[model samples]
Target: MSKADVVAGIPGAIGGVPDGMASGVLAGVSPVHGLYASMAGRFFGGVGTSTQLMVVTTTSASALAVGSTLTDVDPDQRSGAIVLLTLIAGAMMIVAAVLRLGKYTRFVSHSVMTGFLLGISFNILFGQLPSLLGAPVRGSTAVAKALHVVLHPLDFDWRAAVVGLLAVALLLGLAHTRLRTVAALFALLVPMVVVLVLGWTNIGTVADTGDIPTGIPLPHLPELSSLSVPLVAGALAVTLIVLVQGAGVAESAPNPGGARSSVDRDFTAQGIGNIFAGLFRGMPVGGSVGQTAINQSSGARGRWGGMWSGIWILVILVALAGVVGRVPLPTLAAILMVAAARSIDPDRLVAIWSSGAISRTALVVTFVATLLLPVTAAVGVGVGLSLLLQLNQEAIDLKVVRLRVHGDQLVEAKAPTALSDNEIVILDVYGSLFYAGARTLQAKLPDPDGAHDPVVILRLRGRTSVSATFLHVLGDYARRLDALGGRLYLSGVDPRIRDVWTDDLLHAQGIHIEFFAATSTLGESTLAAYADAEVRVHREQRP
Candidate 1:
């Protein structure tokens, strides 16, 4: 790595240390695990990732998810469970990569993601409230914990609260000044010094939780004896959270030279990072939006910046393990609270509300579901809501417009209030023809009454696929027309659809359905169908 890369990595490494430490607390693991996770993720993930600026590290969402998953495990067994879960999640990510499921990330609609992030933000704030107030609040959900603190305020430790509040103030206040780069560090350090100088015995430090290992953790496999369904489920949840969050980071942090990054490659990179992190007994990691942004703004030119950031973190872990132990828990809690608060975007919520009722409902349902349910369950709810939203939109947008040949041009024509004997109608079907949309098209079609042997020509040039429901509708319409001694012509049929449509089956039913090539112009197909309709009318008139 060049000198410039090292310089650029300094800010990222500095910011990552505290952020990772905070994530560990969120994950209900030792703070040093967070540091190890960041280091392992950056080095391993950076080497494999397509996006040079992306910094893979511990994220708040994954951390909270881990904590929720392992809440019931024995304290001593929790660390091992965490490692096993991370490994499982990493394996899932690798499977997703090999299956090339990255394109499915597009299905995660903006409203759903917005709602999820909002829910996670709330979780973080409420989840960290106990630490922020230095209260021994015990509950499963963030709301329950907050309620516990409120109901028993006397249990709060004033010294720890002071440290947390001061850290928050410093972090928020210094962000507006020139010291913003080092603001988090200062916020942590100043509060620690105050607690130490004043001899605040009631305040808990990192050492209170567990000893900080002086060197890198040796690679080892977590015990598989205690593995259970819940652990596997949690790993699946973590994998999804990582993929979604990583996609966001990849999208937001563009390469300096403007080359597009491959989402699947990045997915594989994060999987590799998680595997190493698990082996090192570190927390699960993904592409961190905050850290990546810092790396970019710090003028990082290539992947080496992220690689060096991991190296610097390793140095810190070895040289400053003793100092890290002395850092107060509330200070870290304060940092996390501020970061969580920043993640919640009220403006985005308002935008979702104003977009439309369907979109607004999706946002609200996902948000509420995420708040009330575990992160894993909430993902299912969000995906279901997204599907419903898509169906609703297709149902509303499906249309069948009448077309007429006016001189050399084929233009849209208003459907006549009534049809005349021997008249032919041409219709253009638009939008998706799947499920509910097909029903909408069937209902919107003009009636064949008042016309003797009337023929209907449907233009379907752009559609690539047809559902069974749509085919059934077409068959029913063709039979109705056939009974009237008329015919139905499908003009401009896409080859792909025609291949799947089984034309022989419909012809065997005496429906008299004729299909025009997709390459045929709409005017040519309509003229051909019109001539055939004229021939049918003449035949019907013969006596």
Candidate 2:
């Protein structure tokens, strides 16, 4: 809100324009739409988000998802379809915020994010190769396009390549200097001037995409007559990509004042931004880690920096349209390539690869899917991989330990090699009993074999609910004990779990089942169950 905040934002705004332009090209929309998205997102998102420095703008991942989704639409109708898709994705984000689903973002594990981002980085690099080389490389996937560029190097325009390489060199070389914040601006402008001075009319520039529009467009509803099931699915996919990437931004860019930011609030803010952006025929926008980082490092004091960033972009569009129009496409592509390279972390990928087989496989599969499949489908693959990894970890962590009362203290002990007649065994269950964990527990349960009427006691303390799968397992175990002329004692059973059992059904099946409260001490529960076993043994032997 201060002058300093506004001043800090100027650099970020200048840097963000080329980024937005690059992403717009990636999304197959006018570069100006990217500027519109960035402007709307920063202004509205700054007003609504909890974080002071987080900037919402066009991102490679969301742009790619949007582009892939609109591929089937006719060229004339693609812009309208993109607008509708943005609106739908924004609506979904708002619904998610209302439902308080922001906490669910934590379920997207680190490995999955690593793979997803690596894939996006590669996508951006390969997707821009043709523009960088000034060649018309066409293909469906990043790999295919990359292969095309590699095979047809003869078609590349040397002048455009020189411009792109110069831009890249300046951008990277200036980072170590004091003017690092404005590196992108210099990188873009220097190339534009060189191309203009050299009379390189053959090079493709932003002007080639049609005249640059000044100021914002009026809000209009997109036509929905051409909407399809695939479009809706693509919107959902974009929503997911935005949320995941937004969460990363929120975590990476903390508020300057040290106040905690709410992920749900940020989610709603992004939703509002997207809605306005779509209304103006802009690409979908979300929390951007790169731009927000730049905003913070440039001394952004509050949300005003983000708001000012949008204001500055608007001012440029209105007053400097001619200057922006002359910017070379190869220069923008080179800047994006540098940005994409920065997104990937070789150390993190290596750590994930060395973590374990499951982590390695999940990372590899998600990365490969992102390269080979559409962006939307790649997101699906990442989510599926994360779920499988979670289940596998849970199954491994599930434990069942044996306990014994040594004098006055309860002590952990190994399971007995064999049980005497009417001897009772007390086992404590730990971890989850849901889904795969339940199956794992069932499989790992010790057999009641080689025992004479051995009574088994299971201690399930602190569990609030019993899953149906777990209940089935218990039923099967009870039948096994009943066959051995022994009873099953479920000690420390919460009332909720005990409710799952029916006395009449147990009696009809002649299954001996006993329940005990978890409130009792473990030693007390085990001793009481042991006393009952002794009494039963004496009564049976009396004959």
Candidate 3:
């Protein structure tokens, strides 16, 4: 296992350099910050991460988020702002873990995430076009800037274009070969060497972005006075992006030990990683899908693979820090463009398009928002899309079925649209009865407006609790039935409901709802309630 960790760590470390620098470039920060994040995140986040082989590191999504966050800040102050943002986002993650909010990540919806990721990819691709083309362009968004470069090709430096294209060609060429593991390094080295040897001084290089320190940076504190409303909000956005992406990473690579990974614990692990990253003067980091794939493919069996990769990356950074500054900006741009291109999964996009109207809407809206809006704003839009989808699903999921006793067995059928006089109707509710679900039930249930003396027996057998909205729906139904001398009976209900305020609340709402406790035998309580309803109907008829 130790040997496997060491073996896996090597490839991960090797990829971390270019990958890390690319993330930093994405974040609009110094490339070294990405390296620092790679080291801190892998070491600190992996220490107690639930997903053993999941490599916590700087991710494109988070990097884009950081770029959007500091878009307005002065360049000289971005470093401090980035550090502060990382720490704040990390703290937020820890709070989420403590509050056990990880389970809600599923509610984000696959369609929303897919759209957001697609948006991030396109944003990266379009944003890097200017750098890749070495074209002087200015625009508010990536798409806008790329358009300027395309609309006016005269602004492009042909020399830089050639180098960038060469790197891209190399990436595509080496993708399928045995050297694919180190393809990025090869691409970087080849194009950079060509430019260096030819003395293509016109090509933009890493030195133009920011200064890269020669050794590991010392821990530093963020500027407390710089905290503001926008900064906090940006931190919140970063927190959402990382946690959600981390959840996907955990799902992508299941733990090899057969143990289910705890999402909350993973959240805390990422929090620890970001804290260390900030303290060490690094950028924000999170669970990276590409890096995790490298870890697994390289034979990592446990957390040690990620931890060792951190050490290896640090060693590399210290050894080759000076050379990194000489790497052409166009090469890094090409690497990022290729990576982002691959990140957009066409199959998933096609599936989302075919899923249904609701899913398609989510995907399209989120995707567009990602391209047009700032990274933080796009995140908010994604979250809004997820919530809307969840509510919509709840509405669609609710079902009302009628149950009839045919001899000793109960047969299920579609619920009636209206009830008849002197009738006994048994309804079984399926799916959630909260919020939109309960409102959907209101529409699906039979109309009591025209019915006289119609007894409604609702089976709530496994229900342990009821939402206020559902309770209100029940009260309204009971009141309508009571007006016609009919009664609403609840049978096979969980015992706890009887002791809760729900029982008293029903009476307080001016309706007497008969409650039947569930029995060991299935449908026994319902049958008993039915028998009592029969007696009441028969007595009314005789009178």
Candidate 4:
């Protein structure tokens, strides 16, 4: 929003281009398209959408899905699809704005988001192999295609190859230096000067950028019918992932500037940018944390910084469209390689891999899924796998310790609080109870055998959100208690927990809910509810 924010956003935006293009290449489309969309979409959205310190650009997941489905095998088809998806994704953003679901991006968790980002980083490196070595990228499998490129490096254009390699070296050098912001420009410039001085080295030139219409593209609505159902579904997944990534950073950004990013507004901004880009058959866009940080670092002074960058791009595109052709593709690839290399966090990856069997499995599954499938699909798969593995672990860790009233004090049912005519049994809970926690509830709860009536009180103060599965399990436990001539008393549910536990979907299946106060340092309201329940139960059993 401020000049400082815009300045910081620029370098990150520029750095993101290669990643975006690499995604396009993976999707079997022109890499150049990614660059253009990122440049324009970011500038306009950065300035026009909101005063938030963020950038909009082509995302890896979105590009991959659009490239795979819309592009088809034909380059033209692929290009068309990229253009179409860019517009479609943009339209979706606009719809989000109109509907005001801007805050919906808040629900994604850090664990899932980290998994998506780390998984994509690996895939980006794999995607770049063909261009890095000068081979024609082919094949559906990432590993096989990467190997093919490596094994047949000689088949690539040598002149282009040499320049690309040099670019990589230059970018790496600059990135580690005090002048990383201008790294890409210098990388491109070096190749341009060499070609001009030596006179066009038989190597393919970027002059083939072809003719992009000189007039600015008019805004238009998306053609939803033309894009297939799979493509839309894939787009939705990518949209959610990108929004997750964007919101994650904004929510966590140090509030030093006293201006935190609004997830819903950012989403609307992205949607608006997409519409603009889509109208022009450009790339789909989303908020970029990298770019937002760069803008801050670069000394930008408000929303104007983004506006100025957009203005700068328009001027450059209009005046120097021809110059784009002379730029070397390899040089661009080299810059990208450097960024990708920097993005991988070996320390973090190792920690995730070695944490435990479930974590290790999640890491492996995410890695494998990222390489084998489209990024959007990969995200969905990784999320599903992570949830499954997490749930399995929760089920094993849960121990529904049964406590019962012995005289005036409650104690473990095994000895001090053993079941008696005058005793009431309580199942104390301590863990999450979401989709991943359902199995624990099922396993820890005892089966009712109707011989002795034991009162069951469930304490859910520490538990998180409740899923349908968990509610059903709890319902069954309650019913069993009822059958055994006992009562079910639920306590220690905070307002947040109460809201989740009482959802219509679960309530429709017969789950009578209760609430209580939280007993923590922060002072929760659930504790009072628990006290009230205890009093009611004690009164009912009085002689």
The candidate scoring highest on lDDT is 3
Candidates' C-alpha lDDT: 0.85, 0.84, 0.90, 0.61
Ranking of all candidate structures by their TM-score, best first: 3, 1, 2, 4
What TM-score, over all chains together, does every model reach? 0.93, 0.92, 0.98, 0.80
* RMSD values, in order shown: 2.3, 2.6, 1.3, 5.1
| Worst lDDT 10-window in candidate 4 | 521-530
1-543, model 2: which lDDT tens digit per residue?
899888987988998889888888888777877888888888887889987788988998899888888777887677778888888999999999999999989888788878888988898899889888888878988878888999999988999999999999999999899888889999889999998898999998787775687665568888897588988899999999999889888889877668898989989999999998888778899999889988888888889898899989888788888888889999888988899999888899889889998888888888889888988899998888888888888798898777776665657777554456767678876778887888987777768776668777887778878777777787788888778777788877778876766787666755668877666564566666656766876776675
Q: How well does candidate 3 match the true structure in TM-score terms?
A: 0.98
lDDT of 4: 0.61
Q: List, residue by residue over 1-543, the lDDT tens digit for candidate 3.
A: 498898889889988889989988898888888989999999999998999888999999999999998888888888888889999999999999999999999989899899999999999999999999899869999999999998998998999999999999999999999988888888788988999899999898888888778876678888876577788888999899899999999999999878999999999999999999999988888999999999999889899999999989998888988788888988889989999999988898899899999989999999899999998999999998888878888899898999998875779998999989989999998988989999999998888888778899999999898888887888889899999989999999897877774655666779679888999999999999999999988887885
lDDT of 4 by residue, 287-345 (tens): 66655566557666666555555555555556655565576666656655566567677
Best by TM-score: 3
Q: Write the per-residue lDDT of candidate 1 for residues 1-543, one digit (tens) a residue.
A: 678879988888888899999998998888878988998999988998888889999999899888888888898888888889988998899999999999988777789878887888888888888999999979878888888998999999888889999999999999888888788889879998998899997788888889888876578878897599998999988998899889989889888788999889989999999999988888899999888888887778899899889989998888888989999999899989899998877888788889997778778888888788888788778877777777777789987778887766678977654445666788887788898888887888767665667778888877788899988888888887777777788987778887887668667765568887666454776667666766877888899
Task: Please list the residue runs of candidate 1 whose C-alpha ends up more than 4 Å from where it truly belongs after superposition.
Answer: 415-421, 448-452, 505-512, 520-527
Tell me model 2's lDDT, rounded to 2 decimals. 0.84
